[model samples]
Target: MLLFLLSCFSFIIVFKSSNLYEMVSFLTPKFWIQLFLRPVLKNHASFELSKLDDFEMSLLDLHDLALDQILEQLSPAELCSLAGVCTYLRSKCRSNDMWEKHMEKKWGRIIGNAALREWHWYMANNNKRKYSISGGNNGGSFYSICSWWPLNLVFRPKLQRKSEIKGDLPPDSIMAWYLSLETGEFWFPAQVYNRENGHDGFMLSCYDAKISYNLKTDTFQARYSPHGRRTIEENISWSRLRTPPIDTPPYNLHISDCLDDLRPGDHFEIQWRRNKAYPYGWWYGVIGHLESCSVNEDHCICHDSETVIMEFNQYAPESRWRRKKVSRKDHREEGNEADGFYGGIRKLYSKQEISMWKSLWPTKVLN
Candidate 1:
């Protein structure tokens, strides 16, 4: 009797499990999930119990858990990791709101249009400054210094009449000029009486000087012209001056023929065969530290690979001339033509049109 009863109980257990499986198979997936999974997954304590009663309960619980805390504090490196792990987070990482927040919070406040650009990568270690002079009379603007140092320089001007033009000075006659460190103003009260000729032929003089700006050469070259006698081309005491030219050309015959004399903001004119014509091209003065030099046909070729070449302006309307200024450094940089020469040329051409436009219309209303 006992053996017969045990067999019957085993048969009943198997029959009940078979019926449950068939019922679940007949129901839609949504009904099955609603009747069985949702409540257990939302409550972890209940999920463990349902795991014993239902097979799909554990998977639902894990899916809900993944949508919790971990997504909040994601770094760029972390987001990239998420992209590798699964497809869902990859799409989430690319949301525009996330990127803008990353830029704003992780970065500092915006300074200006220029400040927003990644200019730090291109900037050299040298000190640079930007200045502007306004408010004295006619809206004439004075230039600002561009160095990485602090300066309080004042300008004084000495004017001399051009020798060839012989007549009463026209009210608008702008004579020769000079600047003084003693006074902080650019003055043109008296005629420059030094031996140097104002016009017609080349003339030379030696006096303490600071090159404010070189429009032609686009360089900022300065020197102390001592109180000494020197002819324009004849007595260009290359030794007395801080910098002397290493080479000479017929055009620079009256001046020191030192291409090596280039400084940060000097300017010069060059004759280039462009469009089948020897058009006088302008090259801004820049001495990218002499990275390296090689003797080719008895000429030492040096380069300014890292130096920035401002837009090449020839007879640019805004400034009569564009040019260079001088500073001092003992060590020379190395030469890599691809890195320096072409880079400068590229920079020059990249914004050449915009610069030309600004010059052509300094005060036009932009639409």
Candidate 2:
């Protein structure tokens, strides 16, 4: 009986231990948490996979219209880079329709009819040379309308005004102006200098001048409104420059007899050999339309009869003017500088020569 009871107690203890293990397994925190989160985690993973698949499909199988819409937003440089990626892209990029659209958008207003004709010629012969839609050329056969040098304007102060002043007056200033081919506007870089009384002097502070270039005449016309401050005076200061009356004749007409090869639209600049104040420096006057040119046996006379003159007091700060060595080639070729005023003529065909003369001036483009 004692052996039977001992065996029965051992069996009971074994049964209780097995029951406790089953209860613990059902109540475990880790087991229940994992069971709840598995379905949610699997659904999230599937959604992410679907999103990735859609992205890949959109890029690889986009419609032509969609692709074109995307490409339209890219710049010329960006389009060129994209064209190199594949054969399909290359064909799209080389489409004449696309090029014409780009040209019209970028330079339609800036280029005149003559320039547009030139552009059409370039496109027709595109196979012979590399052309860019943004008016840049990769080869020698093409010239872009946007690449031409802009017309420049110079203003010199009149010395007589300062001489007539009684009290302490502000120093005189010089201005170099340029016309924007795109906007048909006149602008110049603002210059800052210290006044004699330690005040700030802002020269050419106003920019209300409108400019237009006539392709047929090769002449520039500018009109200044009565708006904007022209000077840094305490009171309103108006611009001293006055546009010549419209009735003025062309400068080339006067000298056409002397120069048999005179062409319409040629650029003319007035230059004096000697500066009135400083005899050593080159005195350059405003560039104007060449109304007439007359050459006699003794002297050559070219007049800018239609030129507008800006009269102001002459101010030559020590830092304003610098002496540069006169080229022996220029001096010998041009002959002795005329005493009063000389016309420096440049033809459109001689672009290199024109650039060489323009390089002498410090100011080119203000904007």
Candidate 3:
């Protein structure tokens, strides 16, 4: 018992050492809880919680109300440490409300329905694999279990992972998912601005990719789709990425809601693609008046007309890439194979969005 007590004392020192703890996550709260229990812990861990005697400087020594307040202020690492002390603390730490806050603070910007669906697939597949390895009960087929999950998500009000609940932790819990992301085990689908590692061709635009965190470098890796070729980019920072602001898929045109507000010199992004086989990418453009419209500011009736001209100044004057016209009242897919196709148009509202595009202006005009 003396040796156990001494070991606990030494562990408290290591736990308090922030640098050491981060360097080795395995030395975290879970590790501390299991350190004393050894081979017998799993069976008796919950029972032993009642037997623990709080000592000096231990948060465990505080009243439940006071401890609860302190827990609210603690960061993720601190919560993890406190959780391993006892079953009651573990319950509080693993609560969905707490994990959800952390998730939003860090990942809410870039994670949307698609990312959530992908996470579900990851959890279901992982559970299925574990079941196969362990000879699961009932022995259901993988396809039968997860085939309709994405569709079912639409009608369901809340996400439930009852099937994935097993062992000490539920794989489907928000806490588990957050930890998976923190550890870089999960690569979620999201969009990155100026992708292709800031290639000039993709500047002022965003593209879809499967992105994952890199703990060592505090960066990210993005895996692009393989229509004809596949590529992966590394060391991408957070500022370059964002959740798709709109739900429209890359191939489908984003239904324009702000077209009625288009005016001369107003900035906008129109979906454009080289061919039907390619996905639509948001290209920066400006709304202009028709040749027949009066140049006088007061006499301009361009916005009221059926046709709205979109100009890309980055292209040479004689280049086919310079200008295109779409119906203001009803504009669908417009363009041919020679000049590429143009889809829906979205008026740029935020000054920041406009500034970001201006900053990426090509040094030379496109032919």
Candidate 4:
């Protein structure tokens, strides 16, 4: 490492090129570790170091667009380190278009359309508060800024420019939104696997919750409604969250169109609740072979049947929780309050979804 640093300085002496040396000097040790040592050592590829023929060849010599393309190769942490090099690089590293891909890659699985709506609402609300409308007295039309409702007959004058929102988190940049999410400033609605803090009763189940990041522990905290005798949950790790397959609300039943297409061994999640007063939770299960049907798919006609057999393999063989039969044509929140009503059903078409649930399989069977 010492020799490497000295050789970098030799660039300035040999070619009188300060740009290369300055850029190298500005990079943090963290960036060096992650960008160089970790990747090279892990990959174990034999890469030959190329010699620089021209003294004028430096990162500063590249076109701004070309430089941006190069910087885009860095991870978010590396980008942060690159940002600290200077003001020009800082602006480049903080590009909204750049951070968008990173944000989506990291958060797309766990945050669905509802969470997106929440994010837009959060940003719009913040933007409304941060910027003052110059036409405050124009027929009280300024009220639309706060409400964000449609402006009817009132003409929206061109917004007067104001100073950018003061703080590390500016609403205009996607990076700020990413930071807000990381810092838990914005709470989003998503489903949590085995919710209610992994209570045994919730094993293999997912429930609706308003989630916020816990940066200190690198976990998450979920706020569930005060229904079904379970409420707040904390210390939710990343693996326990997923974007809802459909943007269905907890109270409303999900309309199922895949009923006629159901087959044995197919995976699915169906809504269930003990009573009408309680919100529904999604329980993972699989379609089971009907008792009279043969195992062969060639002879199988289960899909044509009006009734579908649902099996919960997590439960013991004799457990009443093991099996449920719901009618396809008449399937609309079937079951008495004593047995707990089953609501809408969503088919698991994504292999990732099935694999995620399988990853969470319990070590022991439930009673």
Candidate with the greatest TM-score versus the true structure: 4
lDDT per residue (tens digit) for residues 1-367 in model 1: 8975775566457546654335223222334445555666767753564443444332123343343223334553333333222223334543444444444442222112222221232122212421111111221221111110111000002212222111111111111011111012221111111113222111111122322223333222332233224322222221222211112211221222333444333333222111221111122222232324342424433334323222233323354223222212321222232322110111122254334323332232111
lDDT of 2 by residue, 1-367 (tens): 9985785576457546654335223323333334454556567755543333233232215577756765665554444433333345545654554455565564443344433343355345443442222232131212121121110000112212311211110111000001122222222111111111112221221111233433334433443333323323221111212121121122221121212232223333222222222111112222222224343423333232223221111223232221111221222112243332232322224465345334333332211
Would you list the C-alpha lDDT of every candidate in the order shown?
0.27, 0.30, 0.68, 0.70
Of 1 and 3, the candidate ahead on TM-score is: 3
Best model number under lDDT: 4
**Where is model 3 poorest over a 10-residue stretch in terms of lDDT?**
130-139
lDDT per residue for candidate 4 within 35-106, as digits (tens), equals: 444656555556432211112243445577767766777676556544433445556767886798889898
- Tell me how far the alpha carbon of residue 248 in candidate 3 is from the true structure, in angstroms, after superposition: 1.4
Candidate 1 has a TM-score of 0.17
lDDT (tens digit, per residue) of candidate 3 on 34-115: 4444556447645654333321233345576655655666676655544443445566777786678888998887789989
Q: State every prediction's TM-score relative to the real structure.
A: 0.17, 0.26, 0.70, 0.71
How many pairs of residues in model 3 come into backbone collision? 0
Residue range with the least summed lDDT across 10 consecutive positions in model 2: 169-178
User: What lDDT is reached at residue 83 by model 2?
Assistant: 39
Output the TM-score of candidate 2.
0.26
